[model samples]
Target chain A: MSERLAVLKTYKLFIGGTFPRSESGRVYQVTDAKGGWLANAPLASRKDARDAVVAARKAFGGWSGATAYLRGQVLYRVAEMLEGRRGQFTAEVAAGSGLSKAKAAAEVDAAIDRWVWYAGWSDKVAQVAGGANPVAGPYFNLSTPEPTGVVAVLAPRESAFLGLVSVLAPAIVTGNTVVLVASESAPLPALSLAEVLATSDVPGGVVNVLSGRAAELGAPLAAHRDVNAIDLSGADAELARELEVAAADNLKRVLRPRPGTSWTADPGPERMLALLETKTVWHPTGSLGASGSAY
Target chain B: MPSSPPQSASAASPLADVTASDAALRRFLHGLPGVDAVGLEARAAALGTRSIKTTAKAYAIDLAISMIDLTTLEGADTPGKVRALSAKGVTPDPTDRGTPPVAALCVYPDMVAEARAAVAGSGVKVASVATAFPAGRAALPVRLADTRDAVAAGADEIDMVIDRGAFLAGRYLEVYEQIRAVRDVCGTARLKVIFETGELSTYDNIRRVSWLAMLAGADFVKTSTGKVAVNATPANTLLLMEAVRDFRRETGRQVGVKPAGGIRTSKDAVKYLVMVNETLGADWLSARWFRFGASSLLNDLLMQRQKLRTGNYSGPDYVTVD
Candidate 1:
């Protein structure tokens, strides 16, 4: 056979379901865990973070208003797509975290399972978090969990594949659109996942993956007036504190990860509830008569 | 501050004699210097890139907010919609009362009374789109009646669409006569002539039409009707501004330039403002001489103003739905 040339992959940001280069026209050198030159990832600037927030906010309306059953089905389809590309992710996971092939495959396996776990919770979260309250008056008092609009998520620093899925699935399965800053040192796997998300039933802008510095991307998002909440799981101590202070201006719900948090641990409904708002509705009921007892 | 355009100077201006006949009007309009499309567009693009930051940006935001002609011209418009738009024009941001009121509240002729009442004592003027706007296909008598009815209903300004069919057919005299009639019916209400540049097809035609409107006694030469496939673009706006600038220099009668429609973001508004500052100097910066016939542009300026005030980026949730 004659000598053949190879076509290299171009790493671009997945925003609003399309791969666009950084608006600043800046790209940074990304290296494998061994500190060897790997590829160039788009160095998303403050403007890109601004654009991601806009996209997330635009998608929030349609995604949150969709039926819970539909969201669950869409998220489950993401897992199915991820499974189809498990080999590719395993290689990326190995390069990203310097893990053995077996360990990387295991991480990819757990990530797919994490998606399945979160998908199953989409329709059931409201029941677990909401209930009808007992009131003395003839009124029905009900509390339901609602998505807190656009959320800015900082993916975990390590465990790039599994950790990314663990944080992302919870926010989206609960109907909150996300602008997620991928792992700064190992953003390739997360960027690859964007392809999976696009092909699956996951809607555009539902999960925007920006590969850049967490500090650069997170600051604007936390203080952004339009963002309803922020999850600072991957932020460092200094960065997290700064973001929390900025988030206070808009009264944004903040979800900062506690120390010693493990991505492999059985993630309870805590992450999902953090990105949700409790809306308690009160409806007046007429006195019991021909209609029987009031609800 | 620049003085207003002389109302009775249609006969007194240097170019007044040209509008006396179709042949003369065509000679003057066509004889005018041709536009360099590439150069004009490059200048506009260059001006668009100037970074107006810090205090300068804050001032521009407030200035843009005040210059907006808060318009809602949908076929499904109601009295309630006009009142809400009036409130928004009067005080664009409810959270911050320090925000400046917009220049005008623009609506259909039928909604003028409602808009006038809603913005009654506020400095915000009530502008009505008349003269069979957007198409201008009706007969001259009907179009004039539309203007008279709008003015009678207390419209502070009249936005009329020029007959593109007549203008394109080289019937400048007919188009000029129609505008003069509408201008007479407008009376005290300032008349803004809409060329709908997207349909004008060429820059030279836009320049000629601008001069035609100015000579026919237009208080403002507007860019578009906000209903076309293409509306106020930067290149077309720059061409219009150049026309108004040249007209003022020759006739000593300053005409207002309003780039209406499709200008939705604060960034785009600032670029137009930059063009105005560069092309017409600071004299046309205020609402008296320059205006943006826009609906959503107000909210974006407010969001940017809020962002600058608080040192953080803002979202759509903070701004009202309108």
Candidate 2:
């Protein structure tokens, strides 16, 4: 047992496919249910946030511009990988969220299903929600909803795995870049999920997962003008309100806190649609009145 | 026994007997204390000072407006107008015999048949405002009956207005009961409950009503009846979208949001769309969750689509569908 303990591996932050310690080089210990030290989570800083934003902005164009069908395929790959590692997630979630093994397994299953759900939505959303407009004028008009570029996510605290997946999958599926702040106390599973995303065809920087206190990191992300939206799911009431006000600086889209519920609840279409932008373009129809009409 | 016709008993009430007089309702509404207490001067001043930037996102902007009134299509020429709008995808200028059709055509119990027949095979869906639309002032039985009748008549979706009078009068349980009753009658049909934000009268009320509707099994929580003066605006839409998003987080039941009334142009539609996307994200961008309710909005969107597809900008008259 001592020899096995000696062989325990170290974890690092995943940024743009490369693992690095916090630029701050700070490490914090995360514990299991029995008060035993499980692993060290990177104590991410403002510099890390800036680095993530840079990575996300760099990756935005390629990921968001990818055809919806291709995006869906990449998401499906992530789901497949997650499915392969189901036991790992179940163990980690049980440790992190302090749930029973059976409950943890169910959550892991739901999280994987969530990934597949959003992946399927990538290609079909546009056809279902947008289309050519029938205008009163001779104009080629169309209203298609597009991704709102880079987004910053605050994963829910209680159900770390599913919450993180819920926010990340939707943000990336529609082509927007994401910087996710995993639950501070329960960061291991989030880091592990990142490993799955890394192995999947998900483009680096499309999702940058950081493990740290949401209070320390969330404000900067919410207030960051470059961050188009903030999902304040993990934050407390005070934090949620503060982020809401801070988000107003840029009129950033702020998804307020839903009290008394974890992220494992039924995430219907409403969650996905909340983070999209509809662009309706109008063009002049070049036609003269009755020019070809008979006398 | 089969449930006695829903809302059947409530037909005996004075409110039910009140004639469908738009003018009388307008007058009564105008006479409300708050309606006149806030002067147009103060309102104008308030409006000028507030520069509300539109938040464009996936979830916030998907608005589904419930149109229960078909006055715009009521005439000897209405069927022709409906047919023309359905066939050509354009209408003459309102001042010049052309009023653009809305994102959808919302009709009532009887009119669902006409709207469905007219809009069939067209991309437009035939939405019927059901479960005691506008007032929802009837009994639960009658409201459910109304919903059943509309769905039976082929309403693709049902938009039921909550009992605002009950809600404002502190009858939350009653409001919940009524919405649940209507929801029960919906069966497989989609249910959208109008909050009548103007009647709710404040952001707090709007938020509260939003939650109440979601709690009572509303598929979509909507913002107003265009008949009201204070119609759907960016601020109201923002508040409602936040509620919907929060509700999703809590119940895991993602309720759709619709901002009906006063949305009449492509710009207006885009602004609302931007709000949804920026607030909710990409998950709610589909027509399944989002829609616009305007009598004249779709034509503008169509015209914009045409322009995007073709480099040329065609006049409304020249851009006939057929």
Q: Write the per-residue lDDT of candidate 1 for residues A1-295, one digit (tens) a residue.
A: 9888976789999899899999999989888888998889999999999888888888988999999999999998989999999999999999878999999999999999989999999999999999999999878999999999999999999889999998899999989999999999999999999999999978899999999999989988998988988999899888999999999988999998677888889999899998888999988888666667553
What DockQ does candidate 2 have relative to the true complex? 0.01
Per-residue lDDT of candidate 1, residues B5-58 (tens digit): 223336555675787789988888887777788888898899999999988998
Off by over 4 Å in 2: A1-5, A284-286, A289-295, B1-322
CAPRI classification of candidate 1: medium
Local error of candidate 2 at residue A13 (angstroms): 1.3
C-alpha DockQ of every model: 0.79, 0.01
Error of 2 at A230 (Å): 0.9
> Candidate 2: lDDT of B84?
59
Superposed by TM-score, candidate 2 places the C-alpha of residue B109 at a distance from the truth, in angstroms, of: 77
- Give every prediction's interface RMSD: 0.8, 18.4
TM-score of chain B of each: 0.95, 0.70
Model 2: per-residue Cα lDDT over B12-70, one tens digit each: 34223212343432332232222222342343234334323333211122232222122
| lDDT tens digits by residue: candidate 2, A1-295 | 4455466757778888777889998989998878778888899997698678768878988998899999999999999999999999999999877789999999999989988999999988887668898999868899887888778888888777888888788888888888889988899988998889889888899989888989888877876656788888889999999888888876778787788765767787766777889999987667555785422
